[model samples]
Target: MLKTMHRPFHVSPWHLTLACGLFKLLLAAAAFALPLSQVDDLPRLVGLLLLAGGFSELLLSWTGRHSWVGRITFGSGALTVVLGALFIGGPWKGLYPLGPFVTVWFLLRALLSIDVAFQSRLTPMANWIWLLLRGFVDLALGLLLLAGAPLAMLAIVVFGEVREFVTLFSATLAVSFAIAGGGLVAIALTQRHYHRSDPFMIAS
Candidate 1:
């Protein structure tokens, strides 16, 4: 006799994990496959990937339903959507614009992943180390973007003279996505519980 005005939505944690995993893999693939030869196309491709991440984050927001984490994710997802569009704009060409955005986006999600991975301390996940590793990697990338990248990278992003730098960035991006994505997929495949559920309201 579950009677309520609002229908409750039940969500599968594994499903969310799967969706996210697939998305991360796709992003990685796109990053690796992008036509780096054509510098003009890099911004657009990067924008598209960012948009994908935003969309995926939006979808994943449901997993956090009714929780602070969910609310934060929802907000960040919205911002990502806008930023993705901005990146796609022709004015924001080159790595300069995308670098900062990517850094922030990765850092935000990295912390989230680390926070959730802590659940393993109590729940004990066999592959929990991977999650921690992912977080550390993400943190490193963000820090690099903030300061680790050579100061001249800004000039390189603008002039496109240092093809090597761009190559390195793309490579790093691809690796990050691969590892993070794989972790998500593994988490989903192994998860055995439903995080939440939506039930139809029975009018009594």
Candidate 2:
């Protein structure tokens, strides 16, 4: 019987989720710690954050490749990666407007969070409610940026207080990322508990 028995090692998917969550938290901390003197580097920071998030999404898509969730995750990840590359590659001062770029970023992120929340409902994942709330928070932040971006740009142009605008933008991104990271960490911990109780339970 011992010769016939086999045990295969299986790494839990939540491990990746946990790592990604912790990474995002670190990113959030970095963003929050940015000083006013380094405001000029905000674009690069944003680009890096986008790249990190995009890669995480791409990896996550593998967990559900045959489902609609996977398709959306892949698409979102691709777009985010492209946008992040663009932001990092060029100065973008004369190429395009920052308002629209930021608006789209926030919107895409919001949609992804909302999609994840809905998908979580189909799984044994805990903290689906928190994911839903996080989605709404992302949505609200995106909408607020969409509505106020033009006004903010106008103010920047009139007053030439570019630093102030960058400051506010950085702060907003920091808070959003922090919330998202925290939510992920919480969900990952809960999923770990569930997994321990039942080895069959998996979180995607």
The candidate scoring highest on lDDT is 1
Q: Which pairs, if any, clash in model 1?
A: 8-198, 8-199, 9-197, 9-198, 10-196, 10-197, 10-198, 11-196
**Best model number under TM-score:** 2
Among all windows of 10 consecutive residues in model 1, the one with the lowest summed lDDT is: 192-201
- Tens digits of per-residue lDDT, candidate 1, 36-154, equal 55777777777787788778877877665675445655665676677678778758656665677778877886786676556443332224676778878888877777784666466
Instruction: Provide the lowest-lDDT 10-residue window in model 2.
Output: 1-10
In candidate 1, position 11 carries an lDDT of 36
Off-target runs (Cα >4 Å) in candidate 2 are 1-12, 35-37, 94-96, 196-204
Q: Model 2 has how many clashing residue pairs?
A: 0
> What are the RMSD figures for all models against the true structure?
6.7, 6.4
